[model samples]
Target: MAEIIGVIEQLWRYPVKSTGGERLDSVEVDERGLAGDRLYAVRDGSGRFGSGKNTRRFRRMDGLLRLSSRLGHRLDGPELFDPLGRPVADPDAFLRAYLQRPDVALAREDAVSHLDQLPVSVLTTATLDWVRRAAPSAVVDERRFRPNILLRTPPDTPPFVEDGWFGREARGSARSGARLTFVRASERCAMTTVAQPGLPHAPEILKAIAQAHDGRLDALAEIAMPGRLGVGDTLSLV
Candidate 1:
């Protein structure tokens, strides 16, 4: 038997890694993850992917967040837009100019994965509500967390509900019948506090998470069954 926990509230796809993304009403989930998600990334001369923080595979490049991407068609790659939403004729050139690094270019992910952690990141409204209560003054938005799937739980559901979802699986109550295993809780990072176009630089967002939630929020998932997912699909735990 499966228990209904929530309805899918939002679907997000990041065509380019470390950049702002587009919201969709419905999307296809595959073995790689949400289609078009992190399919492209800005690669530097040294081959590090652009990100908000430094890592073995990523280099700190906050300028990437100022841009956004939209997937036009599956046959072609996604298009990059400037902060004002104007299309860039040469994404690679624009990245080099914007970041003042001529060696950087927009490249597709190859053998190396562009994802910071797991394939899919999930967040719940219950946890968002809890963050709001924790930091009554700071701006709290789901975009900061960059979740691929945002689930809206019942109104009375307690905060941090996703904490208990690790190792469990969610089956979509839709024709596609997508299934996902909650692999683990997603750890917090400096990326959450990085300022984007509409979002401000709020370090306190991470501070609240560390203090209240042990420096973790939401969950990372992997596709157990690949299929389509929509905003209204119900995710049931098995």
Candidate 2:
């Protein structure tokens, strides 16, 4: 049997797709997922999911934007944060300042207001290594997958293999005492290929995974219960 080794080393949540994510020391889990995960997304005037897929058409949505939770810094509350952590105007005003487009900002606000759930995504270290081995030239990181949790595991394990834990409870260290279950493996998209500052040649890495791994590279998990997760938490395969 594989032994329980370590706790979650990293925790991340992308309030908005294609933008920068927020790192947390610990978070609570619910049926949907880490609170405030993927709560809002940017859409075009046509209502299609906007992202780096059509950078030229959606250039304003390309770069990284910051986010915060509206519910008192707790994961259980709504995820509504200013990109810069400053109290700014409504979503439109803030986005207009950051993205430089009143039209785009208004569209984003409209899309976000109707969202039913947060878009919190998670990943594991094992999965990242798998991609790195397959595509040595490709740069793989949380930015590419945009996951909420980045759990560390044995060096030899494959990335996202623990996703089998979906529907099962995983208990870990005191900091990450929350219950977790594997949900699904995140699907790769063209965004993986986009080049950003401090990260170059990323698309090749994701492409390599698709060519080698049947178009899957990372996994997503849901929190069965709300709890704190931190570095050094012991992960037991219960």
Candidate 3:
């Protein structure tokens, strides 16, 4: 039996890693997850990718959250843009100038994975609402989390509902026919506190998650069946 969980509230794709994303009504998904999500990333001389925090595979880079990237109409590749909405002629040069690191350049994801974790990230409206209530001062926008799919749970549903969805399978109730398997609880990160357009630098959001949820929120999933996903699609667990 499949139990209805919620409606698909929004769909997002981050064409470039560590930068802003664009909302879409529909998107194609496959084993690699969203078609153009994170196809490109800022690579440093050390081969580390740009990220909010430093790690073995990533280098902490500032001002990435303020920029945005989107796939071209033909889905060829991501086109980079600056905070002023100007199209970057040379992404590498722009990055070098913006970050003041001449060695850092824009490059496509090769053997290394650009994503922080799983291929797909899932978030719920209830969780966002709970974060808002828990951290009254912080801005709890979905952009902070950068989920590929945002499920809109029922109004009465409690927060952290996705915590129990691990190991379960879900399918969309629409013609696109996308299916997913919840793999694990997505751990919260410092990226959630990064400032973006219309969102201020708010560390309270992550602090609340650490205190209340042990630094984890939402679910990280993988595509069980490749297909299309659209807004307003009903998501149900099988």
Higher TM-score: candidate 2 or 3? 3
Please report how far candidate 2 places residue 60 from its true position, in Å.
9.6
Candidate 1 per-residue lDDT over residues 112-216, each given as its tens digit: 999988999989999998888887777889999999999999989998888788899999986867999998888889788878888888888899999987899
Per-model TM against the reference: 0.97, 0.70, 0.96
Question: Tens digit of lDDT per residue, candidate 3, span 1-238?
Answer: 8899999899999998999998889888999998889988999999999988898999999999999998855466778889877889888888999999989987888899998899998899999999999889987899999999999998889999998899999998769788999999778888899888889999999999999999998899999999989899998999
lDDT comparison, 2 vs 3, better candidate: 3
When sorted by lDDT, best at the front, the candidate numbers are: 3, 1, 2
Candidate 2 residue-wise lDDT at 15? 57
Instruction: TM-score for candidate 3, please give it.
Output: 0.96
Which order, best to worst by TM-score? 1, 3, 2
How does each model score on lDDT? Answer: 0.89, 0.58, 0.90
* Local accuracy of candidate 2 as per-residue lDDT tens digits, 1-238: 5357445778776555556567777666666566565555655455544365553334436544334433337533234455455554575566656666555543333433322223334467877777777778776666666666677777777565755665555666655657666556666676676665456656677667778766765555555666766655666767
**Worst window of 10 by summed lDDT in candidate 2:** 111-120
- At residue 184, give the lDDT of candidate 2: 64
Model 1 worst lDDT window (10 residues): 70-79
TM-score: model 1 vs. ground truth: 0.97
